[model samples]
Each structure stands twice: as C-alpha cells, then as structure tokens.
Target: MFYKYETHLHTSEVSLCGHSTGAEMVRAYKRAGYTGIFVTDHFFNGNCTISRKLDWEKQVELLVRGYEKAKAEGKRLGMDVFFGWEYTHNPYGADYLTYNLDKEFLLAYPQLCRLSFKEYSKLVRKNGGLLVHAHPYRTAFYIHYPPNPKVHLVDGVEVNNAGAGSSCNNNHMAWKLARKNPRLIRISGSDIHSTEGAGLAGVAFRYRIKSSRHFVDALRAGDAYLIIDGKITDQEGNPVKEVV
Candidate 1:
C-alpha cells in the first residue's frame, strides 16, 4: 500500500476555527489509513483564538501547543507527524501552508504576519522552507476577491482542497496554473478543521517519507501523487477530475 500523508490540518488547541483537539485529529487520520500528517494550525493572524496581547515569543509558545501535542501522539502511534502553519494573509483571506520550518523559526520571526506576499516568499526561501498557497482560488462571501499572489514566487498551489468541496471553490484555476508552469508544484490537502474532514485529501508517496524535511524535498522533486476523495492521481503531471 502507498504511504498516505495529510498535508493540512488544524486543532482546537490553537486554531479558533478548529473543532477537534490535536490528539483527536491524529487518531482520526490513523483510522483513515494515513501514515502521517502535518499539523498546520492557524498562525498568529489566522483564525487563531490565542491572545495576541501576549508578547511575540509568548504567542509562538501558545501557537505551538497543538503541534507539539500532535507530534507526541504521533510518536506514540508510530506515525510521522510534522509541524507547519497555515498563515492567513490579512485584508485578503488567502492562506498559505508552510513546511520544513520548526517552532523556533516562528518564534524568531514574529514579524511574519506583517510581511507582504513577496516579502514572505523571500523569508521562507531564505530559511529553506516550502510555501504552498492553500486553496488559492477559494472564494468566500467575506473575502471580496480571490487572492492570487505572483504564482511564480510560491513553491506550489493547492489544486485540490477536499474541505472546500462543500463550498464554491475554484480549484480548477489552480490546476490550470500548474499546467502552465511545469516547475510549480501542484499539491492537495483536506484543509481539515475537524475529525470528519480527515482523509478527504492527502498525498500518496511512492516511498515512506522519513521526516518533514524529506516530505518537502519530495514535493519539490515531484515525487508523489495526490489523493482526493479516495481516488489517486499523479499531480506532478496532467490534471484529472478528482473523484467526488
């Protein structure tokens, strides 16, 4: 069987929008046949319930609680748990899923919330991290317009968001962008906020990913496929209709 891994998820310990705790989320994924997951709880400016009144360092400390808890549980279950954040770019509701950076990087760079898309791209690249624009084309009633930053600057675009299937998500546009730019990685995820969202989307790696760093490298090298609604397809190449 392929090694499945969830690329995006949140937890009640950190994200205000999340309904389940980190441990609950991990257990749900484990039951769904996933070998690992990235605990991408909301960042400082995202749908975070944490108090921003606290100092930047303190804020990071609070933000990492969910990831740490999830990681610990993943260890106990023999799952590969990794840390990441879903940064909410203010003004526009565009979200970016980041990987390969640890809790310390976030604590060190609290100003991350203030950076423009261009600036954030540079910072992530400098730190050897990958930034995948989550549901880049997703439009919401609250968000006046769809936020599409310079696609070339981002490492990838989430072309399939299972959680967004319930809404009027425009993932087709992201798929077109990926086809036009062969170098741009086309990723997918559940964008899960609750236990029910688990396993709706994930990646199916040809080999078991050893760590978070390896996961990043695999996507960069186009070494995996996307799993959407229980159907699998090679996202590194031409696009196909995701099973609804």
Candidate 2:
C-alpha cells in the first residue's frame, strides 16, 4: 500500500496568509486520507504573524506553536505531523521549504532572517537540514524580482505547486530545470493554505515515512512518488503503482 503525505501546509496561527488553524488542517488532511503532513508555515521573512519585537527565543517558541498544535491533533487522530518552515527571499519572493530542523535550531540562529539565501542554505545543510525551492517560476504581482533558481544551493525543486488554482506558476519551466540538473530532487506540493484544497497534490511513498528527517532522506534517495493533479506518479509525472 502507498502512504500519502502533504509536504507544504500553513496554519493561521503562524502565517498571515493562512486561513485555517493547525488543528483544522490536521483534521482536514486526516479526512483526505493523508497519513502525515509537514506543517510549513511562513518564516520570519515571509508573512509570519509572530512579533519580531519579542526575543529570538520567544520568536522561536511562537514560531512553532502552529506545528505543535497540529502535531498534538495529529497524535490524537493517529496522524503524523512534522515541522517545517517556508523561508521567503525578499524582493524576488522566492520561497524555500525547509525541513528536518527543529525549534532548537531556530533558537541558535538568531540571525536567521538577516543572512542571505545562499549563506542560510549552507548553514541549514551543515546542520543536516534540507531546503526545497518552491514554485521557482511563479510570476506574481508581489514578486518584484526575477526568479533566482538556486538549484545548487537547494536540496530539491518543487516542480508542481497546486496553490495557484488558475494562475500560471510556470510548473513546466520548473520541471525543465529539474530535468536539466538531474541531481536535484523533484517534489510536488498542494501548498495548502486552507482545507478547501488540501489533498490536491503531495508526495507518496511505498513505505511510511517516520520523521521529518526520514522524509528528507526519502526525497534525497528518490523513493517518494509525486502526486500531481490527483494522480500518483514518479518525478517525471508518469503513472505509478496504486495504493491498495
């Protein structure tokens, strides 16, 4: 049987762009047949709701509240919830989905938001974290700068982002980039800000992923299947095995 998991999700408690609470998202994903989900709320540079005036420690605590709440609900409902955050690169509005790191890591990096994307990426990889570029070719009004696909810096590239319903995210371009790189990991995400479209896209595995770190390992090893447009497929979006 195949196990499904959502890689990108936001909660109202942490992200200003989010519409649902952590518990609500957890319950929604559970109802949609997701075995697990990674709560990837917006980080400091993004649309996070936490106050920067608070100490770094305090910010870290508040930053994880959404994940903590989702994890608690997931535990109660027999679902796995992992922690992650989306670091937004300013001017360009390029967002990176970071995983495997914990609250302790956030506490240690008080200058997290101050560092450049390349510097922060090195630090994250040094500390055993993974970064995936999300929607690299997305052209939106808020994105003042051009696409900076730091393909070398990121561990993976999200070729498909279902967040923009009708708007074009130029997913085809992302796929081309991944194809050209060959070494870069390929992923898909619903980028669910609300429960209305929670299960439209994600990744699936032949086996259940145990932790956030394990999820990263699976992606790095190319063991996870991409779920695009409600179909399970490989990185190239080919038809794949069924869940039974």
Candidate 3:
C-alpha cells in the first residue's frame, strides 16, 4: 500500500493567507484519504499571523500553534501530522518549504529572518533539515523582483503545486528547472490553504513515514512518488504504478 502524505500545508491559525483552521485542515486531509500531512505554516519572514511585536520565545510559540492544533486533532483521528514551515525571502518572494526542523531550532535562531539563503541553507543542512524551493517561477504583484531559485542553496524544488489558480504558480517552469538540475530533489504539494484544495497533490511512499526526520531521509533517497492532478507519477512526472 502506498502511504500518501501532504508535504505542504498552511493553517489559519498561523498563516494570514490560510482560510481554514488547523483542526479543520486535519479533518479535511483525513477525509481526502491522506495518511499524513505536514503543517508547513508561513514563517515569521512570510505572511505569518503571529505578531512581530512578541518576544522571540512568544513568536516561536505562536508559530507552532497551527501544527500543535493539527497534531492534536490528527491524533484523535489517527492521521499523522508533522511540523514544517514556509520561509520566505522577502521582496522577490522566494519561498522554501523547510522540513525535519523543530521548535527548538527556531528558538535557537534569533537572527533567522536576517540570514541570507546561503547562510540559512548551511545552517539548516548542518542541522539535518532539508529546504525545498517552493513555486520558483511564480509571479505576483507582491513579488517585486524576478524569479530567483537560489538553486545552489536548496536541496529540492517543488515541481507541482496543485492549489487553486495553480496555473499562475507555473508548475511547468518548476518541472523544467528540476529536469535541468537533476541534483535537486523533486517534490509535489497541494499548497493547500483551505479544504477546497486538500489532498490535491502529495508525495507517496511504499513505506509509512515514522516522523519528520524519516520523511527527509525518504525524500533524499528518492523513495517517493509524486501525486499531481489526481494521478501518480515518478519524480520526473512519468507514470508510476499506484497501489492502495
């Protein structure tokens, strides 16, 4: 059986752009038949709901509210909930889906928002977390600068984003980028901010992921299948055998 997991998600409690609560998100993904989901809320450098006025400790606490709520609800429903966050490099709006890191990591990095992609990448990899460049070619009014993958600084690239209005996110370009840079890990995610897009895309594995750490290792080992537009495929978007 293939265990499906949503690698990118946001909760209303943590993301200003999110339209659903963490508990609501858990229920939605569970209903959509996902085995697990990562609560990748927008970080302090992004559109996070947490007030910047708070102390570092308080900011960290607020940042995890969504994941904690989802975890609680997921436990009640037997769905695995993992913690993650979307870190944004402002102005250009380059976002990264960061995994395998914990609350303690955030607490330790008081200068996190100030660090450049290169510095952040070094720190995250040194600490066992993997950073996946999200929607590299996306263009929006808020994105004041051109697309900057910062390819060398990322461990992976999100090749498909199946959220609403995904056309604007330019999955094709992301796919092309991943193809050109074979060293970068390839992943797909729903980028769901509400129930309407829950489980629209994900990564599937033959083995169940035990934790966020396991997820990082599994993805790096290329033990993942991409789920995009309701079909299963390999990282290169080629057809793959689907199993229940």
* Top-TM-score structure, candidate number: 2
* Prediction 1 global C-alpha lDDT: 0.82
lDDT of 2 at 49: 99
Q: Which regions of candidate 3 fall more than 4 Å away from where they truly are?
A: 164-169
Write candidate 3's Cα lDDT for 82-143 as tens digits. Answer: 99999998866788999999999999998999998789899998999999998887777667
- TM-score, predicted candidate 3 vs. hidden true structure: 0.96
lDDT, candidate 2, 145-183, per-residue tens: 565577899989988898764225488888888899998
Backbone clash count for every predicted candidate, in the order shown = 0, 0, 0
- Each model's TM-score? 0.92, 0.96, 0.96
Rank order (by TM-score, best first): 2, 3, 1
Write one digit per residue (lDDT tens) for candidate 1, span 1-244.
5788999899999999899999988899899889998999988888898998899988888888998898889888888888899887777877889889987788788788889878988998799889888887776764554454568778888888886672244777777777787777877789888999678788888789988889988988888889877667777434344333
lDDT of 2 at 114: 90
Arrange candidates, best lDDT first: 2, 3, 1
**What pairs collide in candidate 1?**
none
Worst 10 residues of 2 by lDDT: 163-172
